[model samples]
Structures are given as structure tokens and as C-alpha cells.
Target chain A: MKIKPECATCIIRQIVDISIEVTDDEIEQFRLVKGCMPVINEEYHNNAVPAWMGTVIHRHFKKISNCEDPYKRLKETANDTAQNYIEDVENKIKNSDNELDRLKKCVLATIAGNSIDFGPFSISEDIVPMIEHTLNSELKIDCSKELLEDLKSAKKVLYICDNAGEIVFDILLIKMIKKYVNDINDIVVAVKGKPILNDATMEDAENLKINEFAKVITTGSDIIGIILEECSEEFLKEFEQADLIIAKGMGNFESLTEYNLNHKKLYYILKAKCDPVAEFIGVDLKDSVLLSNKQLQKNLANIDKN
Target chain B: MKIKPECATCIIRQIVDISIEVTDDEIEQFRLVKGCMPVINEEYHNNAVPAWMGTVIHRHFKKISNCEDPYKRLKETANDTAQNYIEDVENKIKNSDNELDRLKKCVLATIAGNSIDFGPFSISEDIVPMIEHTLNSELKIDCSKELLEDLKSAKKVLYICDNAGEIVFDILLIKMIKKYVNDINDIVVAVKGKPILNDATMEDAENLKINEFAKVITTGSDIIGIILEECSEEFLKEFEQADLIIAKGMGNFESLTEYNLNHKKLYYILKAKCDPVAEFIGVDLKDSVLLSNKQLQKNLANIDKN
Candidate 1:
């Protein structure tokens, strides 16, 4: 489904909002949007930084009486601003010899990655155990007959990742998917297009060497759920052909749920990371994991058998 | 006030942290030397983005420890990542016609600005009103006189600004100074050299056309108080000759107070923008104007007159 322009803008803000240490309430504002991070990238293509600056500039600019596309104008300005900053950093890097100094700048350059608003600390802490229980037990697998049968028919699999600190786990999931899928090419791992939040981007995938094993793609949308609307033609084609899509983190769940995938199998694997999502799924966000019924049952039985 | 290396690094991280929104207090839990931001910036020459990514690469590369400068290695990798992302955005901008589309990209670019953490919205909100009060009041005129007097004898006036949203006000302050001082060459408005907590950054200043009036500067330091140690020689030279320094926000107050300035006639004119700083000065952060005793008395008397 195509995302509304306002919704898309809001989602873009939301994804970036998530990576920061902003209050849980502030972060919660973004949680309302599904699949947040991908939208931010999508919005970028639409709105430039200087254009974004134009919005702030709008307040300063006296002549423009009616700003029909304030978001657009602001974005263009933000783009100009960004380019200048990138140049500034480049100059700094050219002259500096201090390792610690260089490292801080690299980290600062990776700023968007850091803005992942985790929401209230309490909400974040509260839901971890439940999500852990689900991912560790109900979401785990022993290659059950029913699940394997389903997997045999699966033509392709898309694994969407979230958060840099948690990226190591995503690699583990990719490793697990290789066990179920025969065609390596059929397995697509979608990291962030850019470092919108502390999630693995295409660069991160290359750094982590995930690109070595699988074709890495960014959803081109910032929302957590699968945004069919913003997906590039290439991404969309893969998504359309995919038999199974495994979305990691709350962002994927939110964006994916907005659309009607009909019979396509979609699995959301995330520790209810925030309250709005936890409440939506009828589980505590702190510790709950929402999974495909098939994955949940198979993993639960495997736990029972073990 | 020379910023310590540890403090510089921390401040740089804080600036980046706020911009990227790295909230997990743990992410900020770095070993301090003096100035976290400046130390890191010095080591890398103000290129912290690559440095930040290097830290992550260091985390992984250290497993084998073959690379001589893991940080440098990481810096190279981050450069590749940043370049790719930059190219991607440039490509999109090249392809798109929608002004709104470009605006989104601009916002994406300013993700660094977005990452800057203001701690909590509540904290920022609580203190902003006082600053607004001072800005709105006639009492501001009295302090401006002292500030202007201090600036007149000085070769340069370093006007430190904070908060991106609040920067508009800083512009007004700079305008006031320009109107009174008549020496546009002497005015230097230093924003965050890097993005931190939505503070007025060099990029923001540029976008806002801050340099159109004054020489806008950013310190490599991220200390919360008056950060002099992390600044460049160009800035330091101005600092040395300055008859007066006007600090605009709470972070400056926090970072600057620790180091003793040899009777440099520093005037910190901010509405008690935070509780800790307000408490530090033994005033109500919510309602007080932070000025020297003489300026404070004059401001209060002016308040009574009004």
C-alpha cells in the first residue's frame, strides 16, 4: 500500500526519533507510525536537507507568504546544510592525526544511527523478558515437519534488520535462514539504506560481511513494517516474488501490517521494544514477541520436545 | 578555559549523541580524559563520524587484532559507507522532481541535527521558558548594555549559541550586538562544531544564514560549560583578545564554570534553561535570568520598573 505523504513525513521523523535518548514519550510519538526507519530514507529522496532548512527558514524568510510545500522547502535547505557539513567533516579528516579525535567524528557522522528513540526506559525494560521468551523459545525452531513443509514451498525470504547493537543477532538469523533455504540468492537481507537509527545499514552489512553471504537491500522505506509503496522497483520485485518475509524490529511490524499481503507468509520477530506495539499485539512491549502463528507453534513444540 | 581531552570527547559525543539520539546512557559511558568531543575531534581533526564508525569496527576487528590502527581502518570503512550514502542521496536528488521529495532528503541529511539529544523534552521545556522570559523582557536591554560594554573593549566577542530551535533567538541577540557594537568583524557566534542535542550547530547557523552577519564558529569541544580548550587557534586567538564573552545556553554554563578564566569578564546571559545549572548558580532555573551580580541587580530593578 502507498503511504500518505503526511504519514510518510511523520514516519521519517519517527525513525530518526527512535535512535536518540529522547524521552520515551517523545519516542512513543514515532512508534505510532509503522515501519519508521525506511520512510526516513524514502522521505530523503522527496525532501532535501536545504528544503527542510527552508521550513525553519520559512519562519525567517519574510516574502514567502504561502508555503504550500513547507516540508519540501525545508528539506532542500537541509540538503544544502548537510552537504556543507559533509565538506566540513572532510576538511577536518584531512588535517587531523589524532585517532580518538577521528573516531568521535566517524561516530558523529553516523549520527542518524544513534537517534533510535527506544521510548520510555521502563517500557523498554518491561517488555524484554517476554520478547526474549518468545524469540528464545516460541520463535526458535527444530525444523518441525509442518514448518519444513511450509518452508519447502517458500520461494524467497526477506529478513529486515533493526538496531546496530543488536545487529549481531540479525547475522545469526541470516545464518538460520540459510539452513531453510536452498537458493542462496533467494535469501535477501534488508538492512537500513542509510544509518537512520542505530540499525545496520548497507555499509554495516558490508562491514559485518553479511553482503558476502547474501544480497543486502534497504526497504527504501523507513517504517518498520514492509512498505510496498516506497520500495524501489528492484526491492519491490524481490518482495513480490518472496514466499516468506521475516521483518525484524517493531518498525517492520508497523509498516507491514498496514498492507494486505493476503496469503503471503510474513513473520515479525522483535522484542515488543515499546509500549504502543506491545499493547497493540496484546502483550507487554517489554518482553513479548509477535510471530507468525506457524513459527510460534513450531518453536513452542520444539521447546516442549527439548 | 581549556577543555580536557576526556571532556572534549564526551562533549563531542554528547553533540553527536543528541543529534543521532543515542539514548542508552551506557553508550555515553565513555572513560573521560578531559573533553570528550575536543579530544576526539583533535585526534580525528573534527571528523567524528568516521571515528564513531571506527569504534564499532574496532569492536569487531579487535577479535583478531591484526590491524595496526583499527580506528583508522574503521575510519576508511566509514568513509566508504558515508560516501555510498551520500552518492545514494545525490542520485535520488538527481532523479526526483518533487520538491517535497528533496525536502525529505534534506531532513535525512540533517539526521545529525536530529541526533543531538536535549536530554529530555521535559528538561528542555522547563528551562526554555526562562530564556524566553529574558528574551521577551525589557530587562534584557540592561544586560545587553553590560554585554555590549564588555564587547567594546575586546577585540572579538564570542557569542556561544545553543539549541537549534532557539538559535533564532541567538540571531536576534547577535543582531542586537551588531546594532550596538558597530564592529561586525568582532562578533563570532560559535555554535556546536558538531551536532549535539539540537544545539545551534555550525550547519544550522549556515542554513540559518548566521554567517551573513557574524563569523560563525564551532568548538571541537562538547563540554557542557564554557569550552575553550577544545576550540581551534583561530577561535582561541579571538578568545584571548576578547574583552567579553556572551554564552547563550546552559551547556556553556555547565562546561565553562569549572575552569577559571583569568578575569576575562565573561557574561553568561541565559534564562535559567536547566535545573542543574540553575541550582549550580543558586537560582530557579524555571524563572531566573543567569547574569552576574551587577547585571542581575540591574535586570531586577528594571523588572521592578516595568
Candidate 2:
């Protein structure tokens, strides 16, 4: 998605959130914020997506403030909070009568995990209410039925995880997919090779014991989302091999939606947290979205024809 | 009144609103928006208020876009719309039994005019509903009684106007003050020397026929709000001599609040439109405030003591 005027504001807001977390020095915080404006003006053009812009701006923030992984403590806290709800969520999925119902519940659970993000604003101390709220609410863009059909036929399913605490929830969905849709051997979970925001890394996947359920690998880059050009050749081979890809969070949706990789099917499961993403997905801000590549292509085709 | 992190976001949003109005070229709009970030970063620091920062950033926007007075058409529309309702508003005040009651109603009418601003967002097609809503609503910070008391004793009153459409409402209040509290000869109306945002200029004041009601003058600068240092020698003289100064809009509130001008009384009458301004005034966003310098000093003194 091209950077809209609102995106510039959002990028600065995110920087402020991180700046506050990194330091209590008012002067230093002020300087850090002041420094970001030039980078935003220069780097945030040429139809840059938020994730790509976030990557560049955040790196600059870290360099100036000398605070690597500013979201470190928050990530741990989010993981712990999300860990508490894992059992309850698993039971909710288990309680559903049929396999299709279970699969749909898992998709909702995964999308609920996307809400545990700390990059945009301060991390919520309690995600229990958000988890419950999302579970009860209907997905604004639900392509779960289509996703289930694709999952059944796909040989390999690549699950891209978003935030740290949310990775615990992703485990539940992965387990459900293995039990109902695909073999465990065919499922692989991809995490960031390094930290960018609170996006899960191999370290988080290891901490969550993701390897116990399915194979885990890194995208081989610390970039916020899957910037295909920046990814390692090994990760690309895996990406190209996968029959179905489940992208989690707004970052992935932004980076992936820019190009048409017609060789593979992509299903995005995330909460539309910002205006541009919400407008793009035809949903309200904060609405959970389960969108399919097929549906997106059809929408694009319609727009082109008009 | 000091700049907060939220103010940066708001400034960018305002730029976006103006950029969209200036051009249809996405690339040009993109370039214009990108250019604004550095100005915002550089100007909006070290406890700078929005008005001060806005003055600097908006000047750059105009320089780049080559569109001076971008809000010209919207300002005309706001004036026409507000003019249509002047009769109904005057009637509402006339229905009041006493002078004090009529004065209070006029104060409300003037605040209702402040809502016609088009700088931050698109101009509302109709302001009748907003005026009606504001009329029926209670002021979140009403110092009208105190203002009335000050006006009764004061020999000279300097009334600063905010926007074009709202100036008509200011006329009603100015007329009321002339009839009940002070002579029309003692009253002076101050507007911008040149166009800045949708803020009222000498042209607008003349268009509204403000001379028929009282003496009218310009502040001798095109800056938003009453920057005391930037005022012309004549305006400074009037500003100094006035027994009581009635500053209109959030711009005045911001610029005036920075100094402790103890010699003369100042009453700010405006709607709190943004988060930082609302927080500064201790009112909710969109709430109307009629704050007196006397009350503000008292509040400040109490805070100091605490």
C-alpha cells in the first residue's frame, strides 16, 4: 500500500510511542522525535508501505537513542499475558462440534493474536478483554470457508507469525491445522530473523516451543514484513514452494499486497488497525479481517475494469 | 499549550487536508506532504505551541505549493452559511429578557462561529446543525459572567476575531457589549493583516461590514493567533491600551497563554478542537471554552502552591 498522508502521521505516532518507552529524558525524547521528521519526509515517499517505512524509521530511532529492542520488555510482557489465555482459547476451539467450526474458531483466534501489537501504541496490559471481544465479534472480511478448502488441498502451508505474545495463539491454530487440514510434516512457521517492533523472531518461537508442534524457520531478515527482494534465497525457495501462505498482522498484509505473486495462494489474517489498511480491505479500523488472495485479485480486477 | 506528541500527528493531518485541496496530482501531493515533515520536526520542538509551529509549517506549505490562501473558497462558503443563520441567532438572543441573558447568548453564538474553521479538515457543507447543537449545549468552560463584569468596568476592549463565518457571530456579541456594557467607540476589532489558513483577514471583516458596528483594525501580521511580538506597532499600542482583551479561537488561547500580561484582562473564547489544546485547557475535545486570564492566573497560582 502506498503511503497516504495519514501514514506519515501514523509513522510519527509510532516513533513517539517507542521514544517514550526508550527514555524518560524529556530533552533526549524531544531530539529523537525531531530527528525522525526528516527521515519520514525523505524515506516515506515513492509509494512506501508502512512496514518498509517503519523498518527504516525505527532503525534510525534505535541508532539515535542507542536503545536496541525498545519493545523488549513490552514483548516479554505481551507474551506472558497472551500465554495466560492460551489454554482458555484452546478449549474454546475444542468445544466447537465440527472440524470446519474448529478451523473457523482457529482463524478467529489467530486474528485475535494480531491485536497484541505494541508498535502502534503502548502495549495494553490486559489483552484478555481484547481476546474475548474479538472472539465474540464477527470478522469484517471472512474468507475462512475458502481458506479451509485451500488448506485441505495444499501440500505445504507456510504460517507467518506477527508479534511475540501472539505467537502463542498462532501455535493453537497451527496445531488445529495439523490435526484437521494438513500433515504436521507439511506445516512450517516463519518468524523474523531479527527483531523489528514486537514481531516474533526465532527466539520467541523457541521460547514458545513452536518447534514442538511444527517446523520453524526464519525469514532471514529483520524487516517488519516479507520484503521479497530483501529475503534470503533459502527463505525465498521455501516461500515459492509453499502452496498456501497464512500472513499474520498488518505488516505482512502491507508488504505482500503490493505485488501479484500468482504462483502461490496468500491468506491474510489480521485486525485492520489503521485507516489506510482498513480502507484497502474494505473494513472499519479495528475490525478483524480474514481476506484471501483470490478475493483481493477479484476486487483489483473490478477496479481496473471500472 | 506546549506541543505534545499528538500535535505532530495533527499538524501532518492538517497538511494532508490542505494538500488534497491544492492538487489532484498524487505525486505532487505526496511531494508536498513529504516536504512538510522536516518543517514540523524543526519548528515544533522545545515546548513550541501549535499556533507557533503551525505558523512556521504552513508558511513552508504555501511556499512549496504556491497556493497562498488555500482556504479562500471554503472561507467564503463558511461566511455565507453563517450569515444565513445570523438572524435566527440574533432572534434567540433577543428572546432573552435581560441584558446579561442576551450577552450570555451572544457569547455562545460567537463560540458557535469558531466551529466554522476549515484548516484542519474539510469544511462542513452545513454549519446550521453545528450552530444549533452548540446553542443547545452548555459551555464546558464558561467565564461569560466574569467577562461581563470586566467589560462593565473596562474603558477599552480589544476583540480578536477567529474565522470568517464566525466574525458575523462576533458582530452580534460586539453589538451586545456596545449596547449593554461599553460604548461602541471604546471597542476595537482585530483581524489578520494577510490570509493565514481560514483565519479572518481585513477583507473578511470588511465583507461582514464590521465597521458599521465598531472600530476595526488588523493585527499587522499574517500569523495564526496573537503573537504579541509579531504585531504591528499600532496593534501593539491598541493591545497595550485595551482594558480588557477578548481573544477568539484556540490560536489566541495558545499564543496568549504563554505570557503573563498582568496589566490587562484577557478572555479566550474558543472551541477545543485537538487533543493537546483540549488537555491544555482541561476540557474535552470539541468542548467550547470561555476562559479568563484572571481565572487562569488563579489556577496557575493554585498549582504552584500545590
In terms of lDDT, model 2 sits at 0.82
Off by over 4 Å in 2: A73-98, A116-140, A181-185, A202-208, A232-234, A279-287, B76-105, B116-142, B181-183, B278-287
Give one digit per residue, the lDDT tens place, for model 2 in B235-298: 9988988888999998888888888776668898988877678866777887888888888777
Give residue B1's error in model 2 in angstroms: 4.7
Q: Model-by-model lDDT, in order?
A: 0.44, 0.82
Query: Residue B27 of candidate 1: its Cα lDDT?
Result: 20
- Give one digit per residue, the lDDT tens place, for model 1 in A1-306: 122112222322322233222223422322322222222323322122212221222222211222222233222333333333444445544454654343233322322221222321211233223322332233221223333455557768877666553454355446545666776787998875533323455655666688766778886743334446656787887777888876666556655665556566766655554444554455553443436745544554676687
lDDT of 2 by residue, A1-306 (tens): 766765776787777777778888767777888888788777878578889998898888878888778888888988887888888888898899887788888888887887788765444345567788998788888888898888778888889888888898888889867764455657889999877888998889998888887888889988888899988776787788888899999899888988777666899999887778887777788899888988888877787788
C-alpha RMSD values across all candidates: 23.9, 3.5
Error of 1 at B31 (Å): 18
* Predicted candidate 1 versus true structure: per-residue lDDT over B93-170, tens digit per residue: 455465344333332232211112243232223332333233223322124445445545566677776556455434
Give the clashing residue pairs of candidate 2, or none. Answer: none
